[model samples]
Structure formats: structure tokens, C-alpha cells
Target: MKNLDKLLEKYAKLCVKVGINIKEGQPLVINAPIEGLEFVRLLSKNAYELGASEVYVNWSDEVLTKLKYKNSPMEVFENYPKWKADSLEDFAKRGAGFISISSDDPELLKEMDPKKVAAANKSASIALKEYRKYTMNDINPWLVISIATRSWAKKVFPKLEEEKALKSLWDAIFKATRIDQEDPIKAWEDHMGNLKEKVDFLNNKKIKSLHYTSKNGTDLKVELPIDHIWAGGGSITSSGVPFAPNMPTEEVYTMPDKYGVDGVIYSTKPLNYGGNLIDEFKLYFEKGKVVDFSASVGEEVLKDLFAIDEGAKHLGEVALVPFDSPISNSNIIFMNTLFDENASCHFAFGKAYPTNIKGGEDMTDEELEAHHVNNSLTHVDFMVGDSTTSIVATTLDGKTLQIFKDGNWAF
Candidate 1:
């Protein structure tokens, strides 16, 4: 086997330098499954080298999580540890940059009760609402990335030997993240520049609404807020530092008016939420709220997700990604949102980000609500873009423009 350590170190450095853009004297916080300890250690080392003053790691274990779900009472699922939420709030208050690593077994909680999973997720979100606001508003830098783990690798390559599967998964991750490039940082710089150009074009058009259609029974219209900001590739922090929120991101996204969406859409890929896989799902919307939904698998989990809160039924984010992107071309399901969401166009339900609008960062909760930005304790992304999908945008000046055709950029 080749020396994987060097590649891992390089990947860590890229994340520290480009993902969160850790600054001098800044604190860094990491949340990851304990299986990612090796990469976490490398990341911590890289953060310190980048002049981070302190680094805090919140380690999690899938086995422990499984045990809790199996043995804990139902009430326990309705409460999140206050100390953990407070720690996140403290980090946000101190302007700490965050890097979250996902490397857990995709089906670890597959057998657990969907209601309990939803309850726990909702409780945690409610507990960390303030922290979520900070990150969502770009008050603090935050990044989400995935690492290859034994269980996750097995899920992706069930036919392969354990060691071979891990290697294949690692290779795919590296390529998707551009870590395989000769100069990964430089590659990211150029990639981000191209995405920014797209964002600028969209912003210049001042799109009023987007019309989506596909052969797969998807026909939806999404209204954009007047001050909607199309963000992609990388985002600037309150301090003017740039950071990439998702390592291999290829989408330009903005929040939609919570009450301005209407139509029906079908999922193009499976959504693995809370360790359960919801596949072949279709959602019907009326006035921007989910009126009905069904899934071929994990239907109960889908129902539990919508019951999280009122905002959970409304569209919070609408993101556009070409079908021929590197991740999509790889033809890997991934079963992970960080990768799948970027592979195709997607929408997030619940908890719209305040930073998605102009002057939104400073807006009060009521003010944001007045703009029709949904607020809730959950945000989940599901893919709906495929080769048959097409989209048109209506500009504020009443000009109609084709944005996507055959799942790629149109004009």
C-alpha cells in the first residue's frame, strides 16, 4: 500500500487553508465521528500551523449512538445535553471557525425508531439555534467535509474486500475534493473563481422566480426574495475572510420565499437522513409548504422529518448544480448529502439561512420572517436534478431566461 498518511496530511492542510480559512489567533472547533481521529489529528495540527490559537474537538462514536438509541428512554431523545449546546454557542460567540467531518456508517441507525431520531435531531437543533444562526449568517466560518471510514466504505462498495473498498472510497473522495490535483489549493482557487462568476451573473439578472420541469413528474415554481443573494464556492466571513462551506461544492444557492413555492417534485437520489435511507420520494407543495409527501422506503422517517416543525414543510434553500459535475460523472451514490447535494440540483427544507439575503445578517428574527425566510430547527437537502430536468428564470425586469437544460447550464 502507498503512503496514505501524506495524502491525508495534504487534505487536512487544504481544509485548514481553504475550507474554513482559519485565521491567526482564532479558535478552531471540530466535530467528527471518533473513526476520523486520524484525520482530525492532522487537521488539528494543520490548524495550529495556520496560527489558530486553540483547537477543540467534539468526538462522536456510532456505536455509542446506537447504544443510546437502543437503551435510552423516549424522553431522553427529546433533550440534548445543554452543556454541548452551550459549548457550541460559546464557540460561535468567540468567532471560532468550525470544521465538521462526516465519516459514519450510513445505516448505523437504520433500525432505530424514526420518531426518536427526529426528536433527537429537533431537540439538538432547538438547543443550538443561536449557534446555528451565527454560522448561517456568516458571523462565523463553518465547513463540512467527509472522510472515508470502514463502514461508510463498505456501504459504498459492498462487493469489494474491506481494505480495497476503503482505498476506492478514499480515492473517490480525494478526486472529488480535488486533493488529487498537483496543486489542490490553486485548483480550488480557479474553481471557486468560476463559480463566483456564475453567482455574479445570477445576481446581475435579479431573478424573480425560477420554473423547473422534468420528465420525472417534477414541475415546480420557486420565488426568490427580492434581496436574495446567490452564494457559491466560497463565502466571506464577517471579518472579511473567505471560506468554503463544503469542500467539493459546485452549486450556487439562495433561499427561496417560504410561502412562494408551488408544485410537485420527485427525488433523483436517495436521502440518508439520521442513518435511514429515504428513497424515491415525491413531495407536493402548495404555497411553498409541503402539502403531501411519499417515499418508497423509510416513509415513516420522511413523515417524522416534516413533523419537526412548521418550517420543516417549507422550502428554505434552492441550489443549482449541473448534472455533469465531477461528482456526478463519477456515478457514485455516496449516500451522503455533502457529496450527493453537490452532484445535482437540490432544495433544503426548513431553517433558511439569514445570510442568503442582502442586509440579512443584521436582520432580527421578526425582520427575516417578514421577508418570508423560513425559520426552524432543521435543514435537509435532497436531490431532484437529472438529465431530463430543465429550469427557466424570470428576471425582475420581466425577461424570461433559460438557466438549465438537460441538467446543465443553458445560457
Candidate 2:
């Protein structure tokens, strides 16, 4: 691929300045793909320039991961290394900023043992459960960004050669993140303001529940917890540092009531979950649980997903995105959740965000459960909205408002 040195620099700057908002004297922990080593070098440089005290990199290689999974014993997947968990937790304790560059191959683990994959994921989640709280509760600033890898790019543009596919995917990513603009940071500020408007309006509505209907056979009702906070664009840590959790963010989301979702919903896009794709799926929800589901592709993977834990059978998040968003208008299914979920309204199955509820960070597990917050080892988002989708909200006081009509903001 041709080098875009300046463009890559701008991207790293935007992530450092706006994504994690690297604070002076604050340490940074970056999880990047081995393929992105050059990018990581640029990121470390940018972070240091912004006065980051130290930068730590944890490099991952999808090829290696798949190799290990293909040959490793099942027992190896059932136990997580204590030292790895300790390192992450220690970083969280020190108020370090985290940047995770997710660039997994959508089909990296296809045909691999689903049992091993599921078990390892579950074990890792359990090992780092406490570390997750820091990110989930906004206790520390953390950001999730994506990079174009050969495998991922090929999946997105299979007809193109590897180089062309990479360039195309990179162009799309830069466009989606506004990094292609002359003043990308300024553009993001303006975009953030637009998203904030929607967040403020939804917060003021004091919505009790939402009813979703669409031509794609989605008809569902989802209830929100009392005092649930709608957040988007960026968030502030308890200590006041600001950070954007995801690049190319377009949704203002909050947690759903664990036991308050019911009806049927159809997926509008394929879900590349943990290296396996699940598409053309329909989930039947009853009392917030996944009573049943059907997926034309990867049905066994779907079964292994919710079977990770009890909370996997229920929804933990409800995010609102418009069908007319920038990414949606691109008309490309990236097959990556970080981008796809931003393109349309989606729901996640697994643990809820503590930051979504008032004083939720301080709430005990039992108290959170009492407040209808679901807990699980997984938080997988699947798109379920399109141009024909409509959403109506009912406020606590009985007034109703059209939140989305024909898949775009109606307010």
C-alpha cells in the first residue's frame, strides 16, 4: 500500500487528543495489532508529545491467535493467566488511559473449535472482570479504534486485490472517522455537538420505554432503568477528563432493563462475533431473555454466544443510530461491529454499562441486578435497524414522542 504518512499522523493525533484525551503526566496503555507496529510507533510519539508520562504497548497478531486456538488443548482455554489480568487491573488502578485498536480478521477463527473459543473468552472475561469495571463505569478513560488489516480489508472488498482492498478500507475508515478532513479535530467537535443535541433531548424526555417497529420484522419493546443517562460523542471520567469510547461514534446509548425487553427483532447486518459471522438472524425476546433465535449462518456460534453465561441470554444495552448516518450512507457493511453498530440502531447481549445508570458505579452486583442491569462475560452488539425502522418513546409521565421515523431522527 502507498504510504499516507500525514493522514496516519492526523488519525493518531485525533485518537490521542479526542479519543483518550491523553492527559499530561498520565500513562497510556495501548493494545494494537502486530501489523500496526508502525502505527503504534506513531501513536506512542503522539502520546509522548501530549505529555503522556509513559506508553505501554500490547501487540496482538490474529494469525498467531488462530494458530494457537487451532492447536491448543481445550483445557488451555479454560484458564486465564493471572499475571495478564493483574497487569490490566493495575493499569486501571493507576488511572491510565487505554487505547485498544481492534483489527481482528472477521473470519480468523472460522471452523475453529467453538467450545475452545467460547471457553477462553469466558475465562478471560472472568479474569479481567474487575479491569472491565474501570472502562465500563468510566472510572478511567478508554478508547476503542480500528485499523485496516489485510484479512479485514479483504472481507470488506473481496473483489479487490490485497493492496487495493487495504487502501479502500483505510480510506473508508478515515472518512468515517473524519480524519480525511483538513481540520479533522475541528470537524469532530462540530459533529460531537450534533450528537450532544440528541443526547440532551433524550435525557430530558425521561423515557420509560421504547417501541420499535420496522418492515424487516422487528417489533420490540425495551424499557429503560430509572434515571438512565443517555451518553454519546464523548464522556467525562469521574475526575473530569474527557474521552471518546469509539471512533466514528454515531449513537447515544444507555443500558436496558434486564427483564424489560420483549418481542421479536431481526438483524439488518451480519455480526462478525469473535472471528465468526452470524447473519440473517432473528432473536425472540421474552422478559428480556433470548427465548429463541435462528441464524442462517453460524447458528452454532450463536448458541455458543449466549451459553457463555446466564446474562448472555438477555440484553444489556440499547443504542440509537440513524439510517442516514455517515457510515450508513457509505453502503458498505464493514463486517466489524465498531463500524457497523455505528451505522444503525443496535442492541447488545451481555453485561450492561454501569455508567448508564445513576450512581451505578457504586452499586453492588446484587443492587445492580435489582435495578435490572444484566451481567455477563460478553457484550456483543448486533445491528437491527434500517431505512424502514421507526422508534417511539413513552415517557414516565405517559407522553409519547417520535424518536425515530423511517430510521432517521424525527425530533
* Stretches > 4 Å off in candidate 1: none
How would you encode candidate 1's per-residue C-alpha lDDT over 62-86 as one tens digit per residue? 8899999999998998989999999
| Candidates in order: C-alpha RMSD to true structure | 0.9, 1.1
Alpha-carbon local distance difference test for all models: 0.92, 0.92
Candidate 2 regions with alpha-carbon error over 4 angstroms: 1-3
Worst 10 residues of 1 by lDDT: 1-10
What is the TM-score of each predicted model, taking all chains together? 0.98, 0.98
